[model samples]
Target: MTRLVAVSGSLRRESANTTLLRAAIALAPSDIAVTLYEGVGDLPQFNPDIEHDAPPLVQAWRALLRDCDGIVVACPEYVHGVPGAFKNALDWVVGSTELAGKRVALINASGRAVHCHAALVEIITTMGWIVVDQASPVIPVAGKNYTQADMIGNPALAQPLLAALHAMAGVPAMAD
Candidate 1:
């Protein structure tokens, strides 16, 4: 099975980006298992002084990234850029080797995310990770509050989602 760990950029209890990751997990193919990782919000702010002996949470976070086959990020734009909390989470791994050569897919669950996505792509690429281009979509699901069951019931949600998964898996895109 292809094990994927998904991260949502929002810290809100009712974040659409979190819902979108759940939906993606539900819509994935049988061979792929997507697990949503909620540690981004729980991570301590990056501290370069303590890089060698990192905090327990940072250690756990890196361990998770190392164990996963791929990573998927569902994010919302904050003032035309990535959220500071999410950015901090990324910073925690800036010097780690966990993400090197791993496959990653970006899902922008906001209407205006061009700049944010571009910046993210650059960051992920700089980490030596391969960003699955076709799977990266600015889906604009900010306020939709969709759940797994809702996506399973709606082809509009399921199809493109499956397509994104397929892209990440290096398979041809699925039809809607």
Candidate 2:
């Protein structure tokens, strides 16, 4: 199975980015498995002093990133950049081989998240992740009334993410 870790940039439990990932999960192809990571907020602040004795949470987080075939992120823009917790979670793996050369699918889950998206792309690329070009489709979902149902039922919202997921799985995406 092609395992992918889907991370939401927003820390809220009912965030639009989270809904986008859930929708993607609902629309994923049979050969792909999407696992949502809910620990971004749970991760403690990043600090190098404790790298020698990494926390259990950090260990589990790194293990998942290392083992996954790909990473998908639905991020929101805060003050024209990434959220602290989301960036913190990513910071924990900067020098690790966990995400080296892993395929990445980036979805700008918010309407006003272009800057954040660009920043995220740069960060992921610098970390040795190959952000899949075809799968990095943008959909405006933040601060909207859209739900997981809208994401799954609406072709506009579902098709692009499905394409991204299929691309990550190295499979041809079907037309909706």
Query: Which candidate ranks first by TM-score, i.e. highest?
Result: 2
lDDT of 1 by residue, 69-172 (tens): 88899877788888999999888888887568988989877657788888899888998888888887767667777766775687766677778888777779
> What residue runs in model 2 are displaced by over 4 Å at the alpha carbon?
none
Residue pairs of candidate 1 with colliding backbone atoms: none
Per-residue lDDT of 1-176 in model 2, one digit per residue for the tens? 89999999888878998999999998887789999999999898999998757899999999999999999998888899989999999889987864689888988776667799889989999999888888888788877868899888888888888888989989888864
lDDT of each: 0.83, 0.88
**What TM-score fits each model?**
0.92, 0.95
User: CA lDDT of 49 in candidate 1?
Assistant: 99
Clashes of each: 0, 1
| Best lDDT among the predictions, by candidate number | 2
Q: What does the lDDT come to for candidate 1?
A: 0.83
